[model samples]
Target: MVNLTRIYTRTGDAGSTRLSDMSVARKTDLRVEAYGHVDEANAVLGMAITSGGLREDVVAVLRAVSNELFDVGADLSNPLVAEPKWEPLRIPPESIDRLEAWCDEFSESLPDLVSFILPGGTPGAAYLHLARTVVRRAERAGWAAAEAYGLEVSAGDEPGGVNPLALTYLNRLSDLLFILGRVANEGVGDVLWVPGKDREPVGERARRQREKIEKAQDDLGRSS
Candidate 1:
């Protein structure tokens, strides 16, 4: 239970703040950096939720993730707890599993990719792509924070050590965002990149590609 009776506390008037463990740390601490990125990613998701052409289901998932980001920040802020019956909230396997499941579910309806894509589709998809990249930055920050504290990098789900599921959830969250971008675009119509097209003019590449397409069609017709 959180009770915020007073809004402004000048405790952090200086350049330092306290962690959930009541330990003093500078604003530039790695734990702060980690949670900062998580907050940033969540902000991006918030902006993305306002983009047009987003489905209700996709928005629902984003809203849920936005809430979980707070949990992630809290988990990072509290390094350790001495209380016997109380522990800081940590990311769980179920969260990571849900991300993976949603990613798989959305990807199943999408067409296979022949080439990498440019991060521009519908407005909603574009925002989701942006959020996906930010989430990746958050994941890297989490990893760095864990390593800096000498926490168990493999797996630790307690207050003192960085939980592997925290990193795993962020990783899977980006994956889910990437696929949800396509889902926002009706599960197709991704802006595909033309490999090696920058080496030559668009006119030249387009002519060649057109011929290749025609030739492929001809081959298919003959086989039929």
Candidate 2:
């Protein structure tokens, strides 16, 4: 069970804050940036989920992603002042394995990538793709912070470093999101694949081609 408290504390009026260890720092600290990105990613994922039409499996994966993101945020919010009395948060390798498995399973259900896809399908799936891109950016920021921390440690300035596994998890998570977007819109009739300007317009040639492809897919779906 969890305890709930709603009392407001007016501690942030000075643009500074306390970490989990009760150490004070500016809100614009790199640690804050790292955690802020994780929070942004989580919010985007929430938007994707609420946009609707996601499969139960996809929702489950997103839920897991949300939980893991919170862990990432918690890990970033506190920098080691001294070797803490408690264990530091880390992204385990098993989390990466789960992401890979889910990506593979979802990708198996999608058609082979013949052309570069424009990210649109269902609204939920489209937002998932957008969130995936944002997650990649966040992962890059996290890695940069980790590298800086490593340099600090190497210089004998600190005793702790960023979790390598967390970076790996974010990398795999982006891949999983791409596959999920593809699978989520499978067989949905409104999928519109935009052609390059060099390609023919939506006249007889394009219409005929689209009809042939969609017909083949419809037949395949019915047969299956």
Candidate 3:
């Protein structure tokens, strides 16, 4: 078990921080950027969990994601450092498979994708969608860092290049969020697909206007 000490060390006072290998780097290092993104993604997911009414199974999956993200962050913090004392922090291929499985499970419940749906749903679902997008950004940052370090081959070997599992997980996560949004809006009422009045073509505007009017009428009836 790691020791937990709250003693303040002013080591980072010069705008530099230490990595897992005890090497110091500027706070703006690429490794820092990558791991910071992971931390951001995890925090956003935590917010979604708090605000979204996720099913028990979904919550379980997200909990697993949180754990994986921590591992990813650790890997980013210490690249190519073979410290036998520190257990390997590789993201296994099975992790990607697990994300794929979850995506398949969630997608099964959603309607066939006939058209692109807008990204507004329940607040929790919307936040999940946002988190998914951020995760993609994080993956891209990781890939860039791998290329910069010329560790592409070794990194790619690890689940999704820098972290193949994370990439796969992010891709599936976006799909899951889209479906979750649909599920959240189901039977709560029809989702109004608002089109841009000024920018949209005439037919599109007319269709969206009709949808808006219908939704307004439904809302009035509910209030009455």
- Model 2, range 46-164, lDDT digits (tens) per residue? 99999888988889889989999988777666564356656666667788898899888877756655345557767987888888888898788877777666522222346356666
Q: Where is the poorest 10-residue window by lDDT in model 3?
A: 152-161
Once superposed on the true structure, which residue ranges of model 1 sit more than 4 Å away at CA?
Answer: 80-85, 153-159, 196-224
lDDT of 1: 0.77
How many steric clashes does model 2 contain?
0
Q: Which residue pairs collide in model 2, if any? A: none
For model 2, what is the alpha-carbon lDDT of residue 103? 84
Question: Judged by lDDT relative to the true structure, which candidate is superior, 1 or 3?
Answer: 1
Question: lDDT (CA) for every model shown?
Answer: 0.77, 0.73, 0.65
Between prediction 1 and prediction 3, which has the larger TM-score? 1
Model 1, span 127-224: residue lDDT tens = 88998998899889878878777464323444355666778888899889988876776633666565565424469767677566445434433432
TM-score-based ranking: 1, 2, 3
| Model 2, C-alpha of 212: deviation from truth (Å) | 11
Ten residues in sequence with the least summed lDDT for candidate 2: 151-160
Best by lDDT: 1
Off by over 4 Å in 2: 1-4, 80-82, 151-159, 189-224
**Candidate 3 structure quality by residue, lDDT tens digits, 144-177:** 7766664543433242124345445555655665
